[model samples]
Target: MALHLFSSIRGHRNQINALSRVVARGEPGHAYLFEGPEGIGKDTVAQALLARLACLDAAPQAADACGACRSCAALLRGEHPDLVRLARDGATIKIDQVRSALGRLRFDPVLGRVKGLLVESADLLREEAANALLKTLEEPPSRTVFVLVSSKPQLLLETIRSRCQVLRFSDLSPDDVAALLVAEGVAPDAARVAAALAEGSMHRARSLCDPARMALNDEVARFALALGTAPPTDAAAWIEQIAERRATLAQAQGADSDNAEADEEPAARTGKTALTREDLQWLLDVLRAVLRDVVLCGTGIDAASLPHARHAAALHAMANRCDIGRIVAVVDACQQLEQRMGINPNPRLALSALLVEAGLRLRAT
Candidate 1:
């Protein structure tokens, strides 16, 4: 089955409306930062904008891609020569790729008057590549448009950001996501939970439609609960957790018993909730989410209103123990550990430090 290209979906009508405003204005700038959570239609917005730019009609301020038009039809088939997108998957967009793509954008379009370069996962650009991108963003080709889409816009350099028009995409309401899911044949209850946990990012929410993501959610819950509530004081309890965590990781990694056991024995540490580096990073992400939810809850942000209420109870409980200020500090600590872990990549030591710090701040009352 074919997926709705962002605006065709019911939940994202408002977003499409906003993008229409940008295009209708015929803004002078050709560079834009399409910022939003994952799967919120940044790429779709970029496409629609690309179509609108090439569109001759001046009516309909909310004018989007004319799906029936030649340009739109070509784009729908992913055959438009005018649309050149650079997306990094599981790696950074190399400096060469960025440079070459920009060079290609300089040419006159094969059919359409305007050309677009949509760089998906823009934040994955390495430092050198990002610097290269900055030059083009500063002085973009007149007939070409550049759209940078990212879930982590902060990863980009400030100078590069200054050159582009920034458009923010927000998550749809749970009611909205649920309605879409139900329309697509998902059960009402399941859609609701996915919407809540997706936290406004429809991409994530849709991915959660799979039963596997639900299992991942459960694992995250269990790990967080054990870390927060269960004190792994002795090496024996730590070993038990190691066994459990390794078992989970093994399944995720699709490891044979021999290989899984090998990684577990040497790399895994004992005593006091020793989390593996991968697990440590994951735990840090989970903890940060928890802290974010704690802040949200304490601020009177109800679970019903937020996306991804899966951990709402945990967030609320933690909020009851700590204030928002403390929660912010905890989040900062988690982010710091995540960076340090990236450089050090020491799971046992990293896990110990993070948990110990968080454990100390467990009760900020």
Candidate 2:
């Protein structure tokens, strides 16, 4: 059987078909950008595209690969000489890597019908690296394709952005996520809960299924509940506990494992041994979800819509003790914290201030 492009992807069928049509028409662009949130199947699509472009036995009108072909087999094994996947150096994609890859692109395809370069987490490309990549995109080689995958395309240089054909991937709906989870062997009930909490991310939903991660989320939820009842003196302690927990997680993941959450997140291009910005943002996201649930409960939204439905009672109690105005403020604070975290702020101080403010606001009413 032929290996259809995006055959295993749960969503983005339209996007996949559009690309397939391009391939069938023999009009695949020399430079393309796959922009979307992490774990939303951008990588899968890229791989499939590579296989399609390199398939030896595929017909000119075919939209997929002949799985039995030697080229297709090589692609499946990730050893195709014509396919090159680039990753970050230490924390960013440095200029050196870009120059080197561009140098390789100067050569003709050693095997397969097309030469392909895939830059995962392309947003991590530094200024110099991006400039170098832009040059290549400007005068791209014939019979070659460059696929740049990034969750944050805005981080890429505008010049670089303008040169590529961009394909946007939307988040998967809850129903779609639930169906996928069920197909992956998760119980129906668990799949529904995980889908609700996934925030349209399969990677997040899968992590939510892990006992350890779920326990961590539960601990955060418990702390959010106790904030309404605990004295103000306990604020610092709660913040410290969260920090300690983050530290432990950071240790478990180690410095190089910053992308362990999604595997596609950029590594430290500088080779530093510490948590990347993404790790801090992830913790903030957890807190933000808790605050969002409190707001939902305060506003009388149905429990069915709550991502943390299992903690509905605690959330309701917290909701009763706080006004809608205060809940909004906390959510706003979380958003601000998330944005600020990108600028290299002191994590401990920033997180402490946000949590303390949330605590004070919840008790105000």
Candidate 3:
């Protein structure tokens, strides 16, 4: 299917309108930097703008592309010669890739009025590659447009950022995310749950829709409840169980299990599978949501208003056993741990520590 029109995108109305106005005026900028949280439709908006610019039958005041036009069809088939897409080769966009892409961007448009270049995850450009790209941005070709998409715009070189017209995108509301999921044929109940846990990321919400991820969420919810209600002495046992389950699930899904090299850290050489940083983060996110629900239950909020509404009974149990202050403390600790996760080398150990800390706080209350 063809890419959705700008009008069809869920959020970023302001950004879309801004781009539409620029296109309508026939003075679109040569380079744009779309910076925002991942999976929040920045790239989608960029593509929509490019489509509008390329459409042959689009009216002067049109807010979207003419989907039936030749240019639009070429885009739909991913055969548009005028559009060049550059993404990281593996870990970074190498100098060679940037050189080649720059060479392509120099060519005249085959069909569309303007040539287009899209650099996905633009922050992954290596130092030399970024310098090469900056040179192109400095002396951009006529009738050409460049869209650089990045979630970590701060990592991009300051000089590179200054040359482009930067557009910032914000997170989508849960309602908007759920609506989009429903439109994509997800069940309403599942969509609402996924959206609530997604933290404004459509990619995360979609992943949460998978049966395996949903099952993992259930386990996390149970673990959260256990932290509140289980005997303090049983904390270690339950934490270990959950950690083992997580490791097993990761293995079942073909996680990173290559034998460690001699120079690797001790944690890697243990020959035992463990939770990754991503796995720990996922656990923390679900735990935070459940804890938030517990706080809501304590404050007499309606069950339906809870993010984990289906776990309202367990949340209430947790809330009744623990006071608001302790629950809040646990939540704060989770947030801090998440913020520090980038430097932490051992995710399984981190998860254990978090669970133990949560148990102590909740048991004290």
Candidate 4:
């Protein structure tokens, strides 16, 4: 497939500059950890580098391989002998795949000066895969460059990490993200939500750029907002939808959605229940956003000051009823819940306990 490049995120100026510098110097390293969240365009940057390296043209800019050259076109078409991409077919990049890729990496480029091995989602590397790739990283073939992309650097072993140059990618500013999304044909409201929900990852915004997730997020946001006003209202309908979403995401992994009737509480049965785990976590995320606005509000900043300030005005208004410190605690608790999502059961109970704990703290003063 031809590389579908995106207009780079604006704040990635330093990354782009650094990539250009690497290409200009013809000094691409043996190993690099392009560490950043999903959708931040690490893949795009890496491809641009590959294009520069693989371009058949050995003109003055041969080092920054011309995009139109035969080698660059071959890379774009996924036919470049020098360009190798090893991505996890699923959740994990296994040892066998790594060994096979390493075997292939030993070969010279049929069309270019260098061999480029791109490992997408390096975090999924099994320990053995990491070890298998280590020797090559330590003693790479001449003109061979290894680029590994990861959203979760913490999951990688430090020894392997120690051998590679680390490049960190950050979340983009909301305005930058919004502009990018809008440019991609996202509606204004969609651009706003995708940027906010994306939390700085362009892949996330683009992947979730779908109408269903956006609509779901809107419902979840609206429901979370409603909870601030009255806890005893039609929370059931909202939670049922959240459970369905949780099941959907889980099912995508081939996990069974065994949400038996007994798993629900008395209140849940009546459609007036507390939040589900998914619902609670999403609420906490929204609450965190709300509290952020509170912090901004307390600082005398305008409600429109945030990345999602337009969508955050009501959240800021809700924040007026919360203490900053309390909001911090709320965020901490939400993080805890996020970390504990798979481990916890009885989603409704977890949500209720979390809410009670947060309510006691928020309503304390």
Give the TM-scores of the predictions, in the order they appear: 0.59, 0.65, 0.79, 0.68
Candidate 2 residue pairs that clash: 90-268, 90-269, 91-267, 91-268, 91-269, 91-270, 92-269
Tens-digit lDDT track of model 1 for 1-365: 01123356555566667666666676736788878776665676666667677653435564644556666667667677777788773356898888878777778887665787888878888898888888777777778888788878998888878888887777777677777777879766567767655666666566567675456555555454334344543423443465466546546645433321232234444334434555555456655665566678888999654433666676577667665676687789778777876467454555556666555565443
Q: What is candidate 3's TM-score against the reference?
A: 0.79
The Cα local distance difference test for each model comes to 0.65, 0.75, 0.79, 0.67
RMSD (Cα, Å) of candidate 2?
A: 6.4
Spell out the clash pairs found in candidate 3: none
For model 2, the stretches where C-alpha displacement exceeds 4 angstroms are 1-4, 59-62, 176-194, 219-247, 254-256, 260-365
lDDT of 3 by residue, 1-365 (tens): 13459988888888898998999998889899999988878878888888888788889999988888888889989778787788877668899998998888787787787888889889989999999999989999988999999988999999999999999999999998989889989877678779988888888788678676677787778778777455654544554565577677655754433221111243332114454566667778888888888888899897666667777778777778888888888889888888987776665566677777777777744
Better of 2 and 4 by TM-score: 4
Candidate 3 residue 112 Cα shift, in angstroms, is 2.1
Q: How far off is residue 334 in model 4, in Å?
A: 8.6
Q: Provide the global lDDT of candidate 1 against the true structure.
A: 0.65
Shift of residue 203 alpha carbon in model 1, Å: 4.4
Q: Which pairs clash inside model 4?
A: 39-202, 39-203, 52-65
